[model samples]
Target: MCGIVGVVSHQPVNQLLYDALLLLQHRGQDAAGIATNHSSMFAMHKANGLVRDVFRTRNMRTLQGNSGIGHCRYPTAGSSSEEEAQPFYVNAPFGITLAHNGNLTNWEQLKEEMFKNDRRHINTDSDSEVLLNVLAHEIQKATVDISIDAETIFQAVTVLMRRVRGGYAAVAQIAGVGLLAFRDPYGIRPLCLGINETEQGNEYLIASESVALEGMGFRFVRDIAPGETVFIDNDKQLHTRQCADNPSLNPCVFEFVYLARPDSVIDGASVYSTRLKMGEYLAKKIQREGLADDIDVVMPIPDSSRPAAIQLALALGKEYREGFIKNRYIGRTFIMPGQAARKKSVRQKLNAIPDEFKDKVVLLVDDSIVRGTTSREIVQMARDSGAKKVIFASAAPPVIYPNVYGIDMPTRDELIAHGRTVEEVCREITADALVYQDIEALKQAISDVNPELTSFEASCFDGVYITGDVSREYLDKLENERNNPTKAAKPEDAGRSQLNLNLANEG
Candidate 1:
């Protein structure tokens, strides 16, 4: 998943957008981009790096505008290339610049349709680019004049929503017109609106998470509903419409378990509260199974799992200790490109405190175990740090199915729990004991916070694709394409380097 933010303000928004991206840096680390509109022209800067490293003073100076959109990308759909760094621009039908979060399951078919039927060229393999082109085409069709209004924009989104199939939350800037934001019909990804009452007028901000909005001093408005579209015009007026035939609110459960920041709230449920609830349930399960009898202390894997670990320790009446000191410099190992890289980075990312682990029976809690590479390394580190026994617990249930929505876990073989039992996975990770949260318990954790949340997009645990599109055949195709080395090794185009474009109706 990526992080996308857009705002329409009376003041210049380049720095505001940059600060928001920094708050959302945890969502994506591969690439960062920002695009702004000035005088009906777009100025954009994007590159493959952390948010702070990607944009310099010179780059920020180039982006001068009162309205803009930003994206921090985590490569899930396409190859990690500079060319795919987003705020993808299409210079037709009022010159649109879009930054998107989540993957398009049917991007290949849509790409073919774009070339054969729509006659629009797709520059990169990134699905965000395809989505942008599709929106541009629909807007072109819906418009009767050179100028577009909220009705035409909403109509275009209505058609676009029907054609697009995936868990996506997008923010797009329509040149001089306004900023537009929308979420998929299933609400699989998060998108929330916020307002800042300025002296000049009311400035609106749309973001993938609430933290981005709050960190930028915007008051938390309600989340953008599933299949809903919101447009903020240059005059700072907000126009909204529900544009889907049968919209539902089945948000991705993984966001609470691991993806989202603990401080952020999605769909009216606090992410921090959900994680704490996960810990409580997981603690009870350990108690039921008599696994808590020998545990001397509970320790988190660092960062994301801290909240769950804290609550779990409290419920089990076990001592909670910070055994691992995480290195702030290293990127998250889970989203790293290769197995070797992830495995190697685990050591560099976290170091065990020997005093906390020495002669102690440790219960190590992690958000979830996907490939088991990092888990294995972490377990080994604990053992070597003088722990008598390493009991591993996952706050989330076993991820047995491929998450086609937005997460990076693709092939079945890459998932340690895909065909393995709990004992088998424990052996693979070299943990003395392994415990996982039950699927129902996981669901209840979120619903406990907000009773309105009855369902979730939890395909990884239950294999229930809410979109009704992902099939066994589709999964097999994805696995084959991903597992094949040659097919996955497409090189980045030469001279594509970092982008600093000034697009001005130059299709």
Candidate 2:
């Protein structure tokens, strides 16, 4: 997943784009970039660093513009290379820059089909690159019939939409043409438009979540509906078009579970409350599964589980304790680079507090366990810290299947729980007892809170692909990309990836 922003506003929007990227940092940390049209000159500033790192005081001044688009990336489509960075620009036939969030399930097939059929040479492995190229190709075709105007742009995007089958939300700015944004048929990811209300007029910003808009002093107008295309011109006149017939929301439920920040709102749903309810869901599940009633204390794994642990403690009438203290400088343990060093990483990433652990039978709460590597190490830490017993509970269900979307995760073979039964998984995590929220319970916890959410993308849990069936080729391609991130991240990949690309670049 990635965070994309586009603004067509009254005031010079350098800082607004910069700040929006700050809110979007959680979505992707690899690199950040911005492209703007200032005084009819296309100004571009992209770096393999955080928004702040990329645009320093002197650098930000250079990006001065009234309209622009920016990106922060998490690698779902291509290897983490500078070449794969986003805000991908094509100066030919005029100029265009694009960024995307979510996966294209048919990416490999599309690439293969396009390459074999059209003899199109695809340089970067990133899907966003392919998407931009596809648009460029279509636009190239339309040039014969019409000039690059609003009507031609609309027709080109509309045609391109039909060919793609997957979860996607994207925004871009076409130099001289205007700013364009669109979501896939399923609305697998969230995109909202905010209006900066001022005496001069309303300034429009399109972002992945409402929080970015709110952070930038813009009141959210509403989310761009699923399968919808929005074009906001320099003059601020706006156009909306819907794509495909089957437009059910099916937004990634995992966004609340892990991806989005606590403050961000998706399809009108609260990420913070949803996590709390996931804990509630797990608590009830454990009760039904017949876990012992008298647990000494409920302890969170720190950070991710802290919120859920609070709810779990309340539901079980148990005291909540900070059993583990996270190393703030360290990123989430699961995403720490390589699986080979994951065992050692668990200790360095989190430390157990002896005060809370001594002689206590602690119920350890975590978000979820895909591969049991991290969980086992954490469980060992609690035991080593002197807990008499460690009862493990996850806020979400067992992640048996792999996430075909952007999240970096183990494969079906690597998932400890994929083939094993609940009892089997219980034995693997080595918990005295274990429990997880069921699919039905998860729906009960979150659905009504957001009426705008037409469908929930629980693809990871239910193995249902909302956009379409994911081809085996795409899965293989993703695994290959992960195993070997290209040495030089493609411009689109670097631009969209969230991994702090400057570090990789420096390395």
Candidate 3:
């Protein structure tokens, strides 16, 4: 997954985009980029680093524009290369730049079609670039004039909705025209619209999470509807059209379990409250199984599982302790690009406090266990720290299937629960006992918070792809890509680098 942001304002948006990217840094840490439109000319800069490292004062000064779009990239479709960093720009179709938050399952098919039918050559393996080329090609076909109108844009997006078959929350800048944003038909990813009204005028923002809107002094307007295309004219007029004939609003359940921040709300459901309910539900399960009697202390695996651990401890009448202390400087291990990187970062990211774990029968709570790599390491850390017994509890159900939407898990063999039973998994992780939230109970916990949300994309746990197109062959291809080493780009070939690329000068 990634984070995408678009802003159309009356003033220069360099700082606004920067500040918003900081809030979304958690969504992606592999790479960051921003593209701004100035007088029908595009200036773009991207690099392989966090937002703070990628953009500087000099770089921001060069990115002069009142309207811009930004992206924090997590590698799901392409290799972790600076060349794959987004907001991907195409000079054709009035200099369009696009950034997206989810993966396209039919990317290879679209790439071949673009090359054979549309005569467009994609330079990078990044799916966002392919998506941009698709949009530009469709927009060029639908437009009768130099400037694209709302009807033409909506029609192009509608065609796009049919062609792309995966989850996407995308934002694009149409140079002289304005900003455009759209969501996949399934609404499998999160996208929300917000507005900031000032004496100068009203500024519009589109983000993957509501927290970015709230952090940027923007009022949460509402979620952009499933399969909806939103267009903001240069005059700040907003036009919207439902592009999909039959759209379903099933946001990814993993977003509530771990992906999104607790402060954010998606589809009228609070992530914080959902996690709390998950803790309560898990607590009930612990009581039902009579495991709480042996768990002397409920300890959280710092940060993500704190809410659930707190509630679980309260429900079990056990002491809540912060056993693991995280190093704030380290990036999130879960979102790391490679398995080796993720494994290496886990130890650096967290350390167990001996005083808290010593002589205690600890019950550790985490969001979810994907591959059990980190869980095994964490369990070892607890033992080394002198815990008498270590019991692992997950707020989410076991991830048995590969997530095709945006998460990096692409192979079933990588999952610890793919063929192993609960006892086998417990033994593998070296924990005294392992317990996971029941799938039905998890659904109830999330839905009880907001009855309006009837469905969720829980493909990882339940192995049900909501898009209905993911096949065994497609999954095998994705797994091959994950296992193979990506061809690294040369330093000079890295797109744009820290310096701004002026598309006008290129032409």
How does each model score on lDDT? 0.92, 0.76, 0.90
Residue range 1-507, candidate 2, lDDT tens digits: 788999988888888888999888878777788888876567878877667777888777888779998998766666677788778876655677888887776676778866887556668877887777677777777776535666666677778888887778888777777888988877788899888777887789999988898999888888888888889876788888775566777778778777788787787788888778887877777677776475899888877777788988898788988878778655555554456767777888898889898998888988878778888888888888898888898887777655765666625656677778888988887877878778777766677566555457775676655555653433444444555556432434433322111121122
Q: Where does candidate 1 stray beyond 4 Å?
A: 485-507
What lDDT would candidate 1 get against the real structure? 0.92
Best by lDDT: 1
| Model with the higher TM-score, candidate 2 or 3 | 3
Best by TM-score: 1
Please give each candidate's TM-score: 0.95, 0.89, 0.95
- lDDT tens readout by residue for model 3, 1-507: 999999999999999999999999999999999999999999999999999999999999999999999999999887888999999999897889999999998988899999999999999988888899999999999999876888999999999999998889999999899899999998999999999998988889999999999999999999999999999998999999999979999989889988999999998999999999999999999999889888889999978899999998998999999888899989988887667987898899998889999998999999999888899999999999999999999999988878888988777778898788999999999999999999988888789889988888888887677777775555555665566556333345434322121221133
Indicate the worst ten consecutive residues by lDDT in candidate 3. 496-505
- Model 1 scores worst on lDDT over the 10 consecutive residues at 498-507
